[model samples]
Target: MLTPTDVLKDKVAVIYGGAGSLGAGVARAYTDAGARVFLAGRTEDTLRKASAEVGAEYDVVDALDEAAVEAHAGAVVERAGRIDISFNLVPRGDLQGIPLTEMSVDDYTRPVVQGLSCQFITARAAARRMVAQGGGVILSLDSGSRHGTPMLGGTGAADGAMDALIRQLAQELGPSGVRALGIWTAGVADTLTPEKLAGAGAPAMDEAALQGVLAHLDSLRMTKRSPRIADIAALATFLASDAASSITGTWINATAGMFPS
Candidate 1:
């Protein structure tokens, strides 16, 4: 039997937004699982740092640009021979805390547009290559906003779009041996901070308020503990490897039992 580290042996993985906290953790986990990781993001400095930490290759590629994503995918194929796993962790610009009735149309649609467009571009690029290469996994993530959390702005609509797209991709690509799937998580403990939350368009809050928010998130989970980056990394690693060949076409609930499937 293959050990944990050998599950992804000889696989070549491409991670869009690989410099972010979640992406970096997943890249490290993929490397540890014996896959060759290529980190792609818009920031060269962070990409360089993350890639160095995992001993993976790095490149600057805007996940939202179709040409850029296609070119990047082509280059990865040229260098790595094939892409066995393609994961998109791009940040969708989601504004929160404003009631849908009080928000402008633009504000309500930003995440839905940006998130779906980027995911489509990257997933299409990877899917075309994977179809030719026999088989691969195309992965993505979203905040579990589909549960209709109030005041979450466009997050729920955006996540719903992504959920539909992944299911559609699975149905269309499965015959070609390409699997499409996603993970649903929100308010990861380590990634949540005053600055990061504000940057993502959340209402600004002091440290105490942030702590209360974290506690609330923990209370919602069945485990009574919010998930950390490692939890997401482990799940991503398992999903990307051949060990999960039977799992695809849906979002693996990584919300720590925050909601039922």
Candidate 2:
């Protein structure tokens, strides 16, 4: 009875980075789940194109600007009636696998500050709306940082801070009927690209190198294979639904076999 379609029927979902590959994948999945999705990003063209794929509305939003994010959230609320789901998929511009000594202070600090601030702004805005409207879900993706990665260049630190905030928000908002949760996904083949990594200060990560890294992670997985974006989307849909009503304040890894507990 609680299929993904049933889970999202008539709901309104907002994805902050909906134009990018990872965000697009989730947007498509959410649209397919019967929610009226809103896809937002910096580029209007990309947002429009990606929104077309999901039959969702497109908007230009700068998630980093709290005022801009608030305005966008208000518009989405006006259009959809209420915000059922809010997902922050903005790029963190994380520093590459540079050696700790080689990494610049700005390189390490920028992502942490950007990520935490963005999460704070977006989540707080959505939480306010959801609280006034009764109930909703907030979702985010991070590396989970369970196993302190030495060369991940402040990624773990940023994600760790996010994880902390989500748990606290879950506690504060659960009584008000808002669910706050996060996903940890490191390797998705379709999204791994040289340009993408370059934007995050990494040299270039080709499909081969990405797959190899994934394979190594798979070897560590309970399932022995890297999970796809679909896998992450599936769980996200569930978490955003009432099915995960009692699952607040937990960091669930959608990775197939990698980083198994």
Candidate 3:
């Protein structure tokens, strides 16, 4: 059995979109757990920064580009020998705040298309190498918006597609000793801000209004507190470890009870 200190000792992990806040958090946690992590994203500057902070290697690879993703995976395999875990944290470009009646077909399908494409590309790249090496894990992060929540635009559709794809991947890859899973959490406290809210198609708000939004989000959870970056990172560390060998196929609810299992 692995200890808490080195649960991922000697493991090699590749994180897509590793420059983002959540990806960087997970990379730091993985490094702390003794994994050799590689950060992949489109931005070299941010990837370099995140990689330096976590003592990881950085690759400028666009997750949505199939050729780039394949090349990146091959490079990682060449350097690290094998990939033990692959995590996708790519943004889906979702435009929320508009009702279904007002949304254009493009607005409703952009996230679903982008989300599935990037995830499928990255996951497939990792899986091919993993299958040859015996076994590994593929992970993703989503909002779990399949509950038909209103005003979310394409988020629900994107979530449903990713969820179904993960389950199907698990079933097909299980015999090859691979595991595919995801985490469902939204309105993360650390990633929330008025600017981000506005960027996601929500109305601009002042500090007071943003706080009210945060409080409303917190109230929706059974814990009455939003999940932080650290919380999600810790969970990712465990899911990537052998300690979670029995877990696969479905998503783990990390929303702090915002939705029932």
lDDT per residue as tens, model 1, 4-25: 8888999999999899888999
Ranking by lDDT: 3, 1, 2
Point out where model 3 deviates above 4 Å. none
Q: Cα deviation in Å at residue 69, candidate 1? A: 0.7
Ranking 2 against 3 by lDDT, winner: 3
Give candidate 1's error at residue 253 in angstroms: 0.7
TM-score of each: 0.97, 0.93, 0.97
For 1-261, candidate 2 gives per-residue lDDT tens digits of 867566788889999988988888888888888889998889999998998887888889899888999998999888879999999988887886788899889898777899999999999999999999999999988876746677888887898899999999999999999999898876665676667766766656777876675566678667776667778888888888887888888788866645554
lDDT of each: 0.91, 0.84, 0.92
- Model 1 stretches with alpha carbons more than 4 Å out: none
Q: How would you order the candidates by TM-score, starting with the best?
A: 3, 1, 2
Q: After superposition, how far is residue 33 of candidate 3 from its true place, in Å?
A: 0.1
